[model samples]
Target: MKSLLDLLKTKGPRDAREGAESNLFTTAFASKLAQGQSAVPWEARAVEVAATRLPKSRGTRLLQSVWAQDPYMSHLSSDRVDRMQRFFAFATISPNRDLIRQDEYGSFMIVLLSGTIGVDRRQPWGEHLRLAETRPGDILGEMSLLDSGIRFSTCTTLTDCEVAVLSAEAMDEMMEHDAPLAASLVALLARKLSLRLRVVSSRLSDNPHG
Candidate 1:
């Protein structure tokens, strides 16, 4: 599968942006996976067992809130909703701890349930470029699922953070059996990309001289 970056490089900026916008809600990639095409190779890393689990009631409430706010989960059937609620594992990260490292292969993405995270890029000289600050309800590490399974930037918790971790394997399994679930995942990723594009546009507009 071609990475979005690779596809963008083949077109002019305007055309690339247009192409991305047009492809946002398409599930062609997921469809290909369903047909038994080669899956993107994600590097396996030791999984960290969650040290804590939310009480069932509290966890269900949290999942309900996420479903209400997230556009991607808006139209899901009750069965899919129940499945998602059970699929995630809660995780907590200490302040200044890295949640994701640039260039590392990742098999899971995180949905911030609370607190903030700083997204950064390492410069060639080893300095960090702070890209954005992500807050509650934001999704992180999704690029790993869509592209090469490699993370493009580092993410660190700015404050102690609580996140819901969803693995790619679980998602693949859901996609293979549930078409609605697959479409919802694609929509969620599309929404994340759209938000990022808007941010980039805003930055460019504010710094027209650059």
Candidate 2:
């Protein structure tokens, strides 16, 4: 399926910004989830194994302390930290576990409060391409989190890692309970996706093979 970004480029998919699951997650990926991980809901699947839930107060403090040093993270004001805390659940994952897998359905996004995550994609010709290594404050599964599209790459915990998760259910609650914060969050995600599309376009323009 074409990404919401792709649709946007052609002046379509107006609902993408509002977290629409219309054609994206409700398609094949959702079926796959029902067939395989049917016993557990989407959010439970994201927690993985060995991920201990951290207390809210400690988690908020930690999340506020290390927004992952990513300058893009600064798009969110630090003053909003306290309010944002309740919407997120903090967990620590043991190493060698896939936080998220390529081409799989995901209903949430994670902020890396601490620890390393290796982001990779499995190419059609059997190559495992290492896309990036996540740092503190890095966000994973955000694209899927926003659009409910299947993940484009796999994100694996390379070491013990602490993360803050924002699930779809939580987002819904936030929208109902705190509309302003929810709008701001959606705007932030839209901006981030736009920037990524621009970067990809520039790279494709530069690629000699293309």
Candidate 3:
């Protein structure tokens, strides 16, 4: 199988790169999932391992701590926790960079391990309306993963930030093979959605004239 980097190089045009890479990765990842192997590729693992040999980043350590205490992850067994950790790939975004853009199609969710991000909605006039600022331990893109739709908001880093990303294919494979994990995930997502709705309701109530 071709490495993801190799596949990415074959895709033409800088503007199309991100989409092409995402599609290629998802297809290859889904194929591995179908074979009952871990969704993360060996090449990806090798890269992560190498990166971690240097002193681990503060964000990485923070993410490890969150996995131990966050309600969304705390219920997992040791083995499941280990497996879940492996499924994620670490990412860092520079300050002012958009982590996700509104209307972009995505098949992955992100856990904000460190720093903050601003979630903004693009108005018809192209001005951005700030919706929320996400802090560490928050999860973004769950709605997209659940519905397979375009991103609803643009998530941009307020400062340098680190995140752990879990692809939809990996999540689906985990749900298919582990009922308990699936239940936990669904419950967590439901709770997150409920919280978000409450916030929206409160905002609407305050802006009744709009």
What is the Cα-based lDDT of residue 147 in candidate 2?
62
Writing each residue's lDDT as its tens digit, candidate 1 over 1-210 gives 234433333433223244323343224344445666533322222133222454545555565666667666556555666666665666565677777778766566777777899998766666666778987778887766655345778888898777776666655444444445555666657676778868856764565343
Per-residue lDDT of candidate 2, residues 1-210 (tens digit): 235444333333233344343333334345557577432233565454658877887788777777534455555577776788888988888888887888767777888887899988776767676667878877777777666666888889999998898876676566555556665666666776777668645754564443
As a TM-score, model 3 comes out at 0.64
- Using TM-score as the measure, the top candidate is 2
Q: Compared to the true structure, candidate 1 yields what TM-score?
A: 0.65
TM-score of each: 0.65, 0.74, 0.64
The whole-model C-alpha lDDT of candidate 3 against the native structure comes to 0.61
What C-alpha lDDT do the candidate models reach, one value each?
0.60, 0.68, 0.61
For every candidate in turn, the CA RMSD to the true structure comes to 10.1, 6.6, 12.1
Residue-pair clashes per candidate: 0, 3, 0
Instruction: List runs of model 3 lying over 4 Å from the truth.
Output: 1-61, 67-79, 125-127, 204-209
Q: What range of 10 consecutive residues in model 1 has the weakest lDDT sum?
A: 41-50
The TM-score ranking, best first, is 2, 1, 3
Q: Which candidate is the best by lDDT?
A: 2
